[model samples]
Target chain A: MRVFENWDTSLKIPSMFLLMMSMALIRDQYLISLLPCVAAILFIASGLPLSLLLSRFRAPIVFLLFVSVFLVLFSEGDALVRIGPVVLKSQGAILALNTCVRVLSVITVGIVMIYTTPLSGLSGKLKRMLIPHILVDIGIMTGRYIMVIGEDYNKMKTARKLRGYMPGKSMARRFGVIVPTAATLLIKGFQQSERVFNAMRMRGYGSSAAGEARSYALERPSISSFLMFLATVTVSVLLIVLEVTVETA
Target chain B: MHIPDGMLPGEICAAGYAGTAALTWLCIKKARSSTEDPARIVSRASVMAAAFFVVSWVHIPLPPVSVHPVLAGLMGILLGWISFPAILVGLFFQAAMFGHGGFTTLGVNALSMGGAALLAWAVYRLLNRKSGERAILISGFVAGFAGVSLAVIFTGSVLILTIPAHIDAGTEISAILAMAAAHLPLALAEGVFTALVARFLLRVKPDMLL
Candidate 1:
């Protein structure tokens, strides 16, 4: 898919940076939340397709359903429906609705951020943030190699399937074989890494980057955007505090 | 176990964030002493990262919930303190990329998930070195299951601890119970999956074991 192509390199950094900052801005209440939700809506409205974006959130949506349905249907509140042992309450529904909205809002904001920033930028940003370079580098390599190993696994699976290797009553036997195969892949990956490391050493890999990589300047924040973000967070937090206080009173 | 944003009470989240940061600082300090060589450091970090990356994505469906093996313990056995950074990195990316978790909760996830790895490392050191195979596998199982269960319990207990005093007793109990119930299958599945993956790793690269 076009969206997936060079996706990590395209829009991961700025989006992630924003996400991190925005998270800090979110308060315990609706004021901070409403901003992100509204921002997500506006972001969706501007050019991004909501359906396509929502499609990215299918997993979270399913999880929300399973986790929240019981909570929403059982607790006491304004009665919506009651069938013998089952009781659906308005309060419960509202609780479920709020959770779903929060989940969607987070997912939407993440999707937009990822779609616009590059993966390299995310790591670069982390390094800039004074996060340990070793951690950042390890994360980058892991993401890169997981895809590598995954592709290797998929290819092996296809080859095995071609040879009449089907999972069935002989599942244990197949599993036994899969272990050795996966090990071989692990060894192969290690060997490859060794060679790559050697090559890098010969080329003086760490010598230059060691010094140059210490710091990178952060992006300049726009005054208007910063203020808007602050306003959203403040208002959302207040609303949530007010709601909880009123409910208790 | 990733705790997404807004999933729990604000107080619980705040407390978790604080607790997580303290533990993470301790882990990082512990890791600092062992970073004598660039090669060793890089390999340990890479392997831990690779293990976590592999485990995070390859989930199996178990009826109501889904689970992937928690290689945290395995990572610890193989990579020691380096697993800390690897985990920190993994949790950060998961939050930034997936929004399956929040930025504020990153430290908490790393501590809960990575803490198991450190614990596994400590436990492995206790068992006979000859039973390294069995030790690693068992450590993996214990850490995997414990990681999932403890994280949930910790998260749940935190909620209980931080509930606003004004919240009714019923609302408090139900929320706590709901959180606990939701995590039941995940713990079992994580334990089983961890055992299998550990077995696979042992067979493939016995050298991976400490």
Candidate 2:
């Protein structure tokens, strides 16, 4: 949870925004697609531990291995082993390479965003983007409650195990508690919100007061890095376009 | 699974993008009509988004690959048709934050998952189980499994429909078929997870279901 604690408390919102922007760019501009991945790598190299980045990458690599191993062994690349009537096309290797590169790119882009931004800052930005205030508030509450419910969940499991609630219990029976538990969790959560709201009201903190706090300023990206990012996106797009044109012709 | 960007074909991604936009618009319109207060509508939308946010990060690696909660069916039973926006937000965040799924395929993933949620709601209603608990679980399983399977079919179809007429139709068909076959287990896993979570919600917060 420590690895992810920073993720939730610090990295959630900004990374999400970056990811969305990168996704949009990847969809349309070929060059922009490359920037997030490259920039992410640079970010990791500068400050983040290389080991952590490598581990983040290891998940997709493992998944990719399963699919590609099948292709490499049975694939007909130059008829490497002519097993009776089968012919392995060299094209299979080419396809696998593209798939691997594509997956890595996607993973790296995600890593970059996570490493660079914090969640509060991201949500603050979204607030300015005109997403409904209520939704953001709910999101904040949800974040707070995940930890709360998660703690309750652990306690329940521990107590059950101590009392001999092991694997022998029916799957149906084991899950039976989830309903009431969720109900209690949410009702409590909602009740807490109501209480907090009322307390704020008593202290003169309601709709208008909350609105004033919402107008705080955000940190802008450094001008040099921003321009460099722009240039990288431009070059990457041009390269992709060149590749596509060459492939088509 | 969230399909990362660049892994999918451009035309297929475009179709997903367009389809998802239309669905979101429809969901917003429905949200407006269903609720009396703007705050209530926003709160309902956030519930789905919040559920999705937690679901994406709880990945349990089953060896070669990692899997997490799909929660489509659970969201459907708990939130009904409103699961659409919830799931769309979740998918959007997952792609953005975790890079689990790509941006281009957002529309397709949302439609596929949202369609499944709606389908579960319909099935649950058809069963007419007044108990609510049993109905929620059943709906969750059906919605989760069907959503994943249908999405695979949709993805394969997208690849086929746009693979250009001359690129050996047979090869494209075979490839998509293989991909679909490989995806069957993942769908079943999603169904089981959805059911478990639905049951959990039923136990912990029965009020959320309504």
Candidate 3:
């Protein structure tokens, strides 16, 4: 949870947004390589367990490989490998590889953002924006209960395990149990929502308890944060322009 | 179909985000103006989103291939107009937690899934009048099939528009069609599954079906 907690949430998000945008736009594979290296440096600076940080990406890297294959199999290029009559293109392969790097880098930026900042910090900033109160409230709850749902899922999985259910059953029976269980979880979750809503309503959730007009103007973020965001944007734009210029030249 | 990161061109993916945002905003506006309590809707949407996150994570077996159920029909019927936000929230968490999809690709994923849920809701609404096993089964089939079928077409269309054709156009088109075709079995399975769940809900809490 505390992987990159040192950085200011308000500062980190905008910069990361710029970084992701830059990564998405930059076509130069070599320039794209620098993003992940930067992410690694940030992670190393955070002093969280290197193993845990790396483990977060293991599944995704595997998945990226699978998806990148699609790009490799279908894009234009010279043939790299052939199976019987089927040929894989070299151009396609490089395109897929470059894409894999960008995807990974973008995800890395996202992970850095969410991990460094507390969810409340992000949501609190959101509330200060013109976003609807109900939307923010729902987002906060969703962020909180993803773990709750995950725990419930694990418990169900354990219970199924304890029952000595054999694996490799008919597809119908497998999803038969799963579909109903998901429905049950949903029904239970719905009931919980009703209780929570009732409790909030009892406390006058939507009414002008604090009087919405009394709220002062939102505080500006720190100068350092603003500068950081500006710098990120400037650098990202340069990266994009440099890559495009190089491509066109 | 969960289109993972880097599968589509960045431009198409960007469009996906914009499309999802506009649709989600519309759904939110509509939901807010509805007679239902906003607080109640938030709570329901949150919990439903939780359900969606869980269902998406659990891999279901389909004999030849294992696939995650889109559950668009179920989400559409259960959450109605709120399905867009609910799906968005669900997808957001999934991306954050499992890296199931990427941050940039989120918009397209949401559009494909949430768009289909909305479509499914409309299909279900059209069939809600007749009350019987026959009507329920047909409704369920249509909802489930339309949900996945439309999602495939959307996913395929996005990739088609973004990816350059050239020599790969034939292969890419085939790939898109194959992806859509692969989901056909799952869509049929979803139909049967939806029918069963809908019938169960009908007996227990018929109001939910409505």
Per-residue lDDT over A65-184 for candidate 3, one digit per residue giving the tens place of the 0 to 100 score: 655677666667678999997778887777767767766666666676666666645655655554456666777788777778778888888888899754457876776677666666
User: For residues A1-249, could you state the per-residue lDDT of candidate 2 as single tens digits?
Assistant: 232323332223334434433333332234434545664654554466667657666545665665454454444346444567765445455555655665566555555545555565555555665554544554554555456545655666577678876533454443344433433444554454445545545655335624643553344545554554555455445555655665566
Going through the candidates in order, state the TM-score of chain A alone for each one: 0.69, 0.61, 0.78
Q: What is the TM-score of chain B alone in each candidate?
A: 0.74, 0.78, 0.89
In terms of DockQ, the best-performing candidate is 3
Q: Quote the lDDT for B142 in model 1.
A: 68
TM-score-based ranking, best first? 3, 1, 2
After superposing candidate 1, which stretches have Cα over 4 Å from the reference? A1-37, A73-80, A120-122, A169-210, A213-215, A218-249, B9-25, B55-67, B93-99, B102-104, B128-140, B155-193, B196-204
Candidate 1 lDDT, A1-249, residue by residue in tens: 243223333123334334434443343345444645555654653366767665666556665675466555654567788889877777767656666665566556556555554455666666665556656667777677667766776787789789986644443554455445544555555565565556656776556555545544535545554554455455445555555665566
Measured against the true two-chain complex, the DockQ scores of the candidates, in the order shown, are: 0.31, 0.26, 0.54
Clashes per candidate, residues 3 or more apart or on different chains = 13, 24, 0
How accurately is candidate 1 docked according to DockQ?
Answer: 0.31
Model 1, C-alpha of A139: deviation from truth (Å) = 2.6
In model 3 chain A, where is the ten-residue run with the lowest total lDDT? A209-218
